[model samples]
Target: MDIKGTGAIVTGGASGLGGATAALLAGRGAKVTIFDLNADLGNQLAKEIGGHFIKLDVTDADAVEAALQEAEGLHGKARILVNCAGIGPPAKVIGRDGKATPLADFTKVIAINLIGSFNVLSKFAARIHDAGTIGGEEGGVIINTASVAAYDGQIGQAAYAASKGGIVGMTLPIARELARYGIRVATIAPGLFLTPLLMSLPQEAQDSLGRQAPFPSRLGRPEEFARMVAAIIDNPMLNGETIRLDGAIRLAPK
Candidate 1:
């Protein structure tokens, strides 16, 4: 879909993949509204991009609903939604101490990553379900963020992988169900990237991770991920699929 003048919402848009996406969308002339917990960064980026920002927790249904309403008030009903609000704190099912990991750790990951994405998309879909098509095109597009770990999870990533796997699992069925509403759903499973979490590590550690990607031999750029998002939005046939944005990297079992 042509992004020009269309309304778009990007969750977790303060930094990292979602941040790049919000900038790209706004640069393409889309009226962007960013939903994130980082108010300072979110507000700064929104102002820089000529967009809007709302402090939101994607897992909260009521807050999400209110944020969506506020965003629509600022920029018309959003026609594009990119779900990038997620977390990936690795933890072993069985820790070094030998006791089982706390169940809350697992549930928290699922709640923020899997259930959170679903909450935003479902609500976005409902809002646009009956809306008029944009420029005679489909109703809207939803691009979700997944991870390669969903497929090849290493040790200490059970909760994180499960959450992303759930996202990958639901893509097709949700796409099929939303088809009648002229909405498309797809997920992108990214490999190692230079996100804030990764950047916090030592430079040498970051370089080691970058070398893991076979071809590129470097970490994936946030803007590159943003570009893939744009490509998916531009193409109508790309639905109900999970595209791996990892540069041919099959993660090792660390």
Candidate 2:
């Protein structure tokens, strides 16, 4: 999709991958609305990019609907929706501590990583459906974020892996269903990116992880992921698939 003048909404747009995507889209002339719980950063980004910011909790259906309405008021209906809001709190199903991972912790990951994505995507799509087509197309496009862990989760990532796995599994069917409406769905399964979470590790540990990459032998940049997102949006044929942005590396068992 040509981003110029198009309305785009990015969840988790305050930081990390979502923030990069939002900035890139804005730079490409898209009218952007950042939907995130981080009011401070979201508001700052909105100001920086001349876009709107809506404090949103993706898991709350009613709040999401309201936020979408607010965004529409600012920049029509969204033609691009990006789901980048997720959490990865690692925990073994049965830890060495001899205690099972708490159900609430596991559930929290599912709620934010899986259900939250669905919540925002569904509400945004519904709103787009009501608004009809854009750019001579039937509707809009949605890009969801997954992780390599979904396919090769290490020992301490059971809940995180399952949640991301669900996202990867649903991409194709969701795209197929939305295709008739010209609404495409695609997913990005990123490997060790140099985001705040990963960068916080000690330099040696980060270097160790980077060395695991097969060729480039380094961590990914958020901009690289944003570039891929732009490609997916521009190439109409790319749909219903999860593309790995990893640098030719399958993770090791932890």
Candidate 3:
């Protein structure tokens, strides 16, 4: 759909990939609302982009519902929803101490990464499904963030992988279900992007990770991911598929 003048909601838009997306969408003339936990960053970005910012946990159903309503009150019904609220703390099933990992750790990742995404998308879709068509054919588009780890999970990535795997697993089915409403659903499985988490590491470490990708031979940039989001929104035929923005890299098991 044409992004101009449309209302768009992006979860985890305080920083990193979501931040770039919120900025890009706003630049494209969409009235954007950033949903994230970091009030400082979210508010700053929102002001910079001339958008709105709502601070809340993505897993909180009531908060999410309320945030959606507030966004609607500000920008009308959102026609674009991007699920970028997720975490990827690495942990093994069995630790070096020869003890099983805490189950809570695993569940926490699933809660925020998998279930959290579902929460936002479902509410966003409900708000827009009955809305009038955009570009004469589509009501809205939902883009979710997955990771290459879902497919090439390394050691100590069990929780992260499982959470992202759930996202990839759900994309097509949700797309099919939302299709009747003219809402398109898709996922992006990014390989190794230079997000805040990775940027905290030393430059050498970041460079090492960058080399993991073959062609570009460097870490993926957040704006590149944002551009992919724009491409998906621009193309009506692209739906229900998970695009790997990995630069042809199949991650090593590590």
Tens-place lDDT digits, model 1, residues 1-254:
88998899999999999999999999999999999999999999999999999999999999999999998998889999999999988899889999999999999999999999999999999999999777776999999999999999999999999999999999999999999888999999999989999889999999999999988999999999999999999999999999999999998999
lDDT of 3 by residue, 140-227 (tens): 9999999998899999899899899999999999999999999999999998998999999999999999997888999999999999
- True lDDT of residue 154, candidate 2: 95
Q: Candidate 3: where are CA atoms >4 Å away? A: none
* Native-referenced Cα lDDT, model 2: 0.91
Candidate 2 lDDT score at position 30: 95
Whole-structure CA lDDT of model 3: 0.95
Error of 1 at 155 (Å): 0.4
How do all models score by TM-score? 0.99, 0.97, 0.98
Clashing residue pairs in candidate 3 are none
- What does candidate 2's lDDT look like per residue over 176-216, in tens digits? 98887889999999999988799899999889999999978
User: Which is the better candidate, 1 or 2, if ranked by TM-score?
Assistant: 1
Prediction RMSDs, each to the true structure: 0.7, 1.1, 0.8
